[model samples]
Target: MTLPDLDPDLAKDMQAIEIRIDGENRCLAAGKVAMPEIAKGEVLVRIHAAGVNRPDLMQVAGMYPPPPGASEIPGLELSGEIVATAPNVTQWKIGDRVCALVTGGGYAQYAAVPAAQCLPVPAGLSMTEAASLPETFFTVWHNVFDKAGLKQGETFLVHGGTSGIGTTAIQLAKAFGARVITTASTDEKCQACLDLGADIAINYKTQDFVEQVKTATNGKGADVILDMVAGDYVSRNFKAAAMEGRILIIAFLNGPKAETNFTPLLLKRLTLMGSTLRAQPVANKGAIAGKLRQQVWPLFENGTIKPVIYQTLPMNEAQAALDILRGGAHVGKVVLEVP
Candidate 1:
C-alpha cells in the first residue's frame, strides 16, 4: 500500500499493529496495518519496541479510552528510529533513534509522534531499554519533581516500588539527591527497591508502611509521597506525609474512589494533585520531552540511570506479554519488540 507522502524525509514503506475490540473479554490484535500518515508537526517513526503499561490494560477492559484527538491504539510510549519528518521540522533525521512520550499508539510497527515529544535514545542503551524509559520516567518526573517539588534530603514515599514506575522513581529521586522510601509487597521486591538506591523499603504485606515510614523518619513523616494505590493507601499516605508535604497521584491500581478527612490536608498544609499522560495536551508532552532530554538523557547516556528490563516478547506474542504484566511477577519493564 502507498502511504501518504506527508514527510519528504520519511520512508514510504511502513507498517503498524492495531487493536480492535471483538467482544467482552476478547481483544483482537491486528498486525501489519498500513503505516500512519504524518500530520503537520509530526514525524513517522519506525517503531522498534513499545512499553506495556497498566493504563493500556484499563483501555482494553473498556474502563479507559484514548483522550480526544489521540490515537485509538492503546500504547502510551515507544522507542524507534525516525523514518520520516514533516516540513518545518529540523534537528532530526530519518536515522535518528528516539524514545517518545505519546498520547497513544505505541503498540504498533510504526507510529506518528509530535516532533516536540521525542527524545534521542541514549547512546549506550539498546532499543529494548530505551523503549522502557518514556512512560514511567516521564510520569515520575512530572509528579515527583515538577509537581511535588521534591528537594534534597526530603523523604519521598513511592508505592509499588518493584513495578516499572516504582523502580524508575527510586533511581530518579536518588539521582537528584532526595531520600526515598518505597513500599513493596514481597521481600524480594523490597530488596529490589533498596538495590535501586531507595533509602528504605517497606514490605507493606508484612508491615504497616505508615508506621515504618514514621519510625524511619523519627516521626517527621515523608516530605512527598508518590502513590498509585489510592484506596486504603490514601489515609495511610496522609498519615505518613509530613507537614507542608505534597502527594501526587498518578494511578489508582487498588481503587479510585476514596473517603478521607480533609482536616489533615488543611492542618498540615498538604497539597494533593493528580495527573495522567493520555489526558494531557500535546504541548505539555512536548515540554516534558524537551526537559527530560536536556536534564535526564545525560544520566542515561552516562550510565547514571539505566533501564531495568525484566523481559522482552515479540509483538505477535502480545497476549503473553499482557499475561506477564497482569501476573505481576516481574520487576522493571516488559517490552514488546516489533522485529
Candidate 2:
C-alpha cells in the first residue's frame, strides 16, 4: 500500500475532548494533549469537522465503549487535511483533504487513521459534509449492498427515515434503482424521506409500518429491511419481509432482545444479521473504503447525492451536539467543527 507523505508538528500539543469518567458518571472536557504519532500504514489528520453519532451518545451513557487499543474519544467519523503520515504510507500526503472512518478519537483536533481507511473528499463537498459521509455511508453500503445484496427493483425498507443512516440508505437505494420505503416518527420527517427519493414514507407514529409495507408491496413485503430499532421490531421484521428477504440490524435503539417464533426463518427464508464497524480490523475497513471510492464517490462528484446536515457546532460545544443527537430531534447529521 504505497501512500503519500505528510509531516505534522509533533512537538506542539493539541486541544482534545476528554471523557472524564468518575464512577458511573462521565462529562466532556476540553483539554490539551500531545499530538498523536502515526503508526505503520497510518496517517494523521488535522480534523476540520467531526460527525456526531448515536454511538457517541451511547459511549457517554456507558452503553458503548471504544474497542481495545482505540482512542477514548467518542467520535466515529471525520474530515480534515492530512498533516502527517507513517514512513511507508504513500497514498496520502500533507494538505490532502480526506474523510475517514475511525473507531474513536474523532472528537479531537487530530486523529491517527490507517491510510487505507481514508477517502478523498468528494468534488464539491465541504469538510462538514464530508465528515457526515463516512460512518453512515459505509454502514449502509456494507449492509445494504454488500451483505444483503439488494438489487435494482427490489423493495428496500428502512426505519428511522430521518436519521443519517436512513437518509443515506434512501438516496443510495433509489439511485441504484431499488424501490425505497422508509418509516419516520412525524409527517414532516416522512416528507423529508420522500424528498430524498423514498417511494413511500410511512409515518410510524400514526400508522402501522408493517401493514403499510405490506399494502405498498401488494402483500409481497419488502425484499430487504434495515432495522435499527430491535426489540419487538425483530419479530415484526419477519412479518414484513418478502419471501427469501434479508433483514439487516445495525443498531438496537429499541433494545436487542425479542420474543418471537422462529417459524419465519424456515417459512420465509429470511436472513437476520447485524454488525458494528468500530471493532473491525483496519484491513476490513480499508476494503469498504476502496469500494466506496470506486462506486459511491462518483455519485457525490456528479451531484447525484447530497449530504443532509442538521446542525454544526464548534468543538467546545461537543456536549451540546451530543445532546441534540441524544434527543433525536434532528433530521440528519450533527457535526463539530475543530478550530
Best by lDDT: 2
Query: How many pairs of residues collide in each model?
Result: 2, 6
On residues 175-287, what C-alpha lDDT tens digit does candidate 2 reach at each position? 89999999999899999999988999999889999999999999999999999999999999999999999999999988878788989878999898998888989998899
Q: Across residues 239-335, which tens digit of lDDT does each residue of candidate 1 receive?
A: 9999999998888887898898878888899998888877787788787777788889899878788899899988777767778888998899899
Over 4 Å off, model 1: 1-15
Off by over 4 Å in 2: 1-10
Shift of residue 89 alpha carbon in model 2, Å: 0.9
**How far is 281's C-alpha from truth in model 1 (Å)?**
1.6
> In model 1, what lDDT does residue 235 have?
81
